[model samples]
Target: MKIDNEPDIADFDAALLLVMDAIWSARNVSLAARRLHRSQSTISASLNRLRELLKDQVFVWDGRQMNPTALTEQLMPQVSDIIASMRALIWRAHGGAEHAHRRFVIATSSYVTALFSAGLLTRVADEMPGVSLDFIATAPNSWTKSVLPDIDLFIVPTNVARTRGLHTARLYQDAYVCIGARDNAQLVADMAPDDFLGLRHVGFSSVPRLTASHEASHWHALGITPNYVMQTPEYLSLPAIVAATDTVAIVPGRLAQAAMRDFALKAVRPPVPVPDLEIVMVWKPAQNDDPVHAWLRGALVDLAMAFDA
Candidate 1:
C-alpha cells in the first residue's frame, strides 16, 4: 500500500478544545475545572499539553489568577470559529435520519423500541444488511417539537401528530392493558374499575410529573389516581420490574403482549375503556418522497400492520 501524508487523528483529540474553551472563559484553573465538571489537576494537565503543542504559555499565574497570554487571546476567536464551522457543516450536511452510512435514526418511545426491536432488526438484517439504527427518545408531551426537524420519522400518537400539523400516516391502532406479576394473588381474569384504581401501580413516565405519562393523564380524566409504587422514565425496564413485583401498570396492548411473552407477567383488560392508541409516523414534507426514508417507512408500516394480525 502507498503511504498517505494525512496526519494521524489519534494524537489530535479535538476534545482538548472543549477544555481549552472552558479554561479560556473561566480564566482560572479551579473555576474552569468546576465549570467543566473536571478536576483541577485534569485542567492543569491539559494546560501543560496545550503549552507544549502551541509553544506558548497559554495561561500564566500573575499574582492572583491565571491570565491568558497574548498568543492565547489571538487563538481564541480562530478556535471558536473552527469549532462552530465544523458543527455547522455536520449539522447542515446530515441533519435527518439517514446518515452517509446506511444508518437510520428513529425517534420513538422505549416501549416502541422494545416492541419493534426484533422485527425491525430482522428486516434490516435481511434487506438492508449493513445498515444500522439509532432510537432517540420521544419526550412525553413534546413529541412534535423534539422529534420533528431532526429525525427522519416520528412514531407517536396520531392526534398529537395531526394537531401539531406534521405530515402523518397511521401505523397501528392499540389500546391500554393492565399488566402485573404472574404470581400476584390479587390479579384475576376480571378487574373492576375500582379494583384497577386500588391496585398499586408502576408508572411509565416519559417526562417529569404525571403530565408526561399517557396512562396517568388518561386515568386522571376518569378521576382515577394510581398508587404509583415506582415511576420510571424507561418503559423497557417496566416489564422486568412488574414481573418481580405486585405493582400493575397500564401499558399499550402490544407492549403488554411483548412483555407477557418474555417475562413472568400477566395482562388483563382495564375496566375503564380507553380510546384506542392510534400510533402514527410523522415526517416533514421534504422526506415525503425521499427513497431511503420511504423504504424505512414502508418497512415500519408493514411491521406495525403485522402487529394487528
Candidate 2:
C-alpha cells in the first residue's frame, strides 16, 4: 500500500503492515501470529515480503529475543499510524461495531468483572457478535507505561488511573460500605464510628495505598487506624474471610451487595462518611482517535450509565 501521497511505494499492503505491527509489539513470531490469528508460517512469509520490499532486515534474533533493526525502528511509528488510520477507515466503511471482529484484552479487578462483565457480555453478544473481551487480573503497579500497550483497556479507580498519563473516561461512582458476617451483631444498622473501629479489618491490597487511604480518609482525618488483621489482593476473597471472622471490611457498595447474595454477609453504612469511588476506563492516548476503540469506549460508557440506572 502506498501510504501518504507517494506512488512508487506500493510494494506494501494492509496485511504486511498488520504483520509488522504485531511482530514489533510482540517480538515473537508465534506471539505475533496469535495476535493476528494467523499461522506462524503465514507471519513468516509476510515478514519475508516486508524485508524484501524494504531492502532491510526488519528484525534480528539476538540469541535471547528478536530486536528491531534501526530501519524497522524508524519505520514503526509511521507503520502504526497507517494501521490505525486503516482500521478507522475500515470501521467506518464496514458499518462500525456490527462488523468489527477482534478480541480485546482488558486488565481489571474481579470487582469490576462482577459489576460490569455480565451486562457488557450480553451487549457485545447482541450488538457486536464478532467482538469478545478477555478480562485479566490487574496488579498494584499495572498502570506503568511498559504495561499499557499490551492491553486495550484498564478498569480501575481514579487514583490508580492517575499513576499513568493515559486517556481515561469515568465509568461509575460508588461509595464504601462496611461488611461483616450476617450473624455478626456488631454490624448494626447505625453502627457508631467507635464501634465500627473496634472490629478487626480485612484490607484489599491489590491497589496502591492511595486507593486504600482514600477509602479510609475519614478515619485518617480523625487520627484513627482500623485494626487490620488481614490483607488480600483480591476483593472477591474478602467476603468469605469476613463471613468467617469478626473482622469487618470496607468494600465498594456494589461489591458488598453482590457478596451478600453469595456469602452470609451483611453490608452497613460506614459510621463516618467515606469518599466516593470513581471507577474509570483507561486507555493509551495513542488509540484516542481510532474509530473502533472510540466505539468500544462509547459502548462501555453507555453500559456503565445503564448499570447505574
Candidate 3:
C-alpha cells in the first residue's frame, strides 16, 4: 500500500532518524557526535544509510558547513513529530517508568551510594523495570552544563545542595557511630573517647574527602586522630573488610545497621561526639521538570525513610 509520492518508513531506522535530528540541529558531524556521545564515524554511517534509503542528498556540504537539501528541510517537522510519537509510545508501554528505555546518570559519593543504592535497586526492580541507574562516585561539576550534560541527579550533603540553588530534597540525616566486628564488639561498645580514638581504625573515604572538609576539620579540632591501620576509598566494602578483620571504623549509623545483618558487625555510640550527616538529592536544573525523574525522586525520598528512624 504505497502512496504515489511517499516513501515507505519501514525501510527507515528509528535510531537513524534521531541521528538525523541531531545532525540537523548541530549541522556538523563532529558537533552532533559530541552531543550524542558518539564517534564521528558512527554518525557518518547513519547519515550515509539515511541518504541511501531516502534516495535524497539529505545535506550537501558547503566549504565551511553542511546545509540541508530542500527535501531534508521539508521532512524535518514531520520526522520530529514522528520521533516524539515513538518516544511517547515507548513511555506508554511501560507507563510506570515514564522515562522508560532511557538511561539516567547520577553523580554521588561512596557514602551516599552505600546508603541508598540497595533500596533504589530493589525499588527499580519492582516498580521501574525499564529504567536503570548509573552511579558515579565522583561528584559532577553541576555548575556547568557542558561539563556533565548526561548527569541526571546529584546526591550531595544538604550544605552543598543548598549552595547550588537547584531543586533539591533532603533524604535523611544519619549520626556517626563506631562500627566493629562483633568478635571485638566489646572493644568499641561502651568504650570511652580516649579508647575510641586509640583503636586501629579502618578509614573509608571517596574523592570528596581527599581534601578535608568541615567534618574532618571538626574532628581535628577535638584532637581526634583515628589510629587508621587501613584506609580505602570503598564505603560499602568497609563493612565486609572490617567485619573480616579486627579493625573498627567511625562511620554512619545507617551503614553500620545494614552491615550488622550481612556481617558480624555492631554499632556503638561514638564517645568523641559525632555530628549528624544530612544527605539530599539534587535535580539537575534541566531535568527538574521531567515527570519520571520527579517520580523517581519521590521514590528515593521513600527509600531514605527506610534507612533509619
Candidate 4:
C-alpha cells in the first residue's frame, strides 16, 4: 500500500491524535471516553472517523472486549511515537524550557511548601530563570475545587486522592516523627507512648479544626490521645514556638529534618504507627504531552528521588 505524501496528510490533527492515543491507552471505548472526559457515543463517533482516516478497523469486539486488529497492532507504536514527536515540536515552537516565560501555578499545603518549595524554587531559578512559580496553600477539603485552572502542577499527600481527568504520580513516602526541642528533658532513649500523650502537644492544624482526624484515627487505634495545648496552621512558626517552650509536634520526618537546625529539634520515631505520607505530583491529562510540563515533572521526580537518596 502506498502512503499519502500530501502535506495535509502529514499535518497533525490534535483531536484525532488524542482519540487514537486514548483508545490505545484504555483498550476499550468506554474506558477511553472516561479518560478523555467524553461521552461514549461521542468517542464512538470519533473512532468511526479515525477508522476512515487510518483505513483500518483498528479495534474490533471479541466477546465483550475491544481487541486491536493486526493493522492497529502494527500502526500503534508508530502513531504513538508520531504523536509524542508532534507534541515536542509544538512545545519547542511555543518556546520550551530554554526560552519559555510561562508561569506555573501549584496548589499544595504549607507543610509540603516547607519541605520542598525552597529546594524546588532554587533549582527552578537556576535552570529556568524566566519561568515563574505561584504557590497556593490548598486546604484539605478544597484542594480539588481551589486548584487554579492554569495550574501546571499540584503536589499533595497521598491521603488526598486524585479526581477523575487528573493524572497522579507518587513522589515519595514519609512517616510521621515526633519533633521537640533538642534540650527537652523528654528526649530519652526509652520514651513510652503515654509520654507523648502526657506532653503538651503543639498541633499543626492548617484548618480551624483543633484535631487532625487522620492523626486522631491512628492514635485512637493505638488507644492514645494527644493533649494539644495549642494548634497553629503554620508549621514554620511551630519551630519558634517549640524553641521557646517545651512543646512537641508530630510532623513529617522531612519537616522535622528541615526545622532541626533552626529550632534544635530532634526527630524521634512515633510510638504508634502513623500513616505513611505519600507525596504525589498531579496534573491534568491535557498537559501530559507538553514537553515543558514533561520536563518539569521529570525534574521534580528526579529532585525528589535525589532528596530521598
Number of the top-ranking candidate, with TM-score as the measure: 4
User: Candidate 2 residues 120-156, lDDT tens each?
Assistant: 8887787678888899996646456677678998888
Ranking by TM-score: 4, 2, 1, 3
Better of 1 and 2 by TM-score: 2
Reference-based lDDT, residue 241, model 3? 80
Weakest lDDT window of 10 consecutive positions for candidate 3: 206-215
- Candidate 4, 1-309: lDDT as tens digits: 555653355543568767887887878899999998999999998888877766778888787777888987667545654565567666756667578677888777776766667777887777667767778876546654445475778887766555456766667887788777889887554588777678888877656765654466566777777889998876667777777788887877777777777777777787766888788777776777776666566667667787668
Error of 3 at 51 (Å): 61
TM-score of each: 0.62, 0.64, 0.61, 0.70
Q: Select the stronger candidate by TM-score from 1 and 4.
A: 4
Residue pairs in collision within model 2: 1-12
Residue 264 error for model 1, in Å? 1.4
Query: Can you tell me which runs of candidate 1 are displaced by over 4 Å?
Result: 1-101, 140-147, 162-165
Compose the digit string of candidate 1's lDDT tens values, residues 149-207: 66767788765554344456667888888788989877666667777777888877766
Q: Please report the candidate that would top lDDT against the real structure.
A: 2
Once model 2 is optimally superposed onto the true structure by TM-score, how far is the C-alpha of residue 151 displaced, in angstroms? 1.6
Which of the two, 2 or 3, has more lDDT? 2
**Where is the poorest 10-residue window by lDDT in model 2?**
206-215
Give the residue spans of candidate 2 off by over 4 A.
Answer: 1-94, 163-165, 207-222
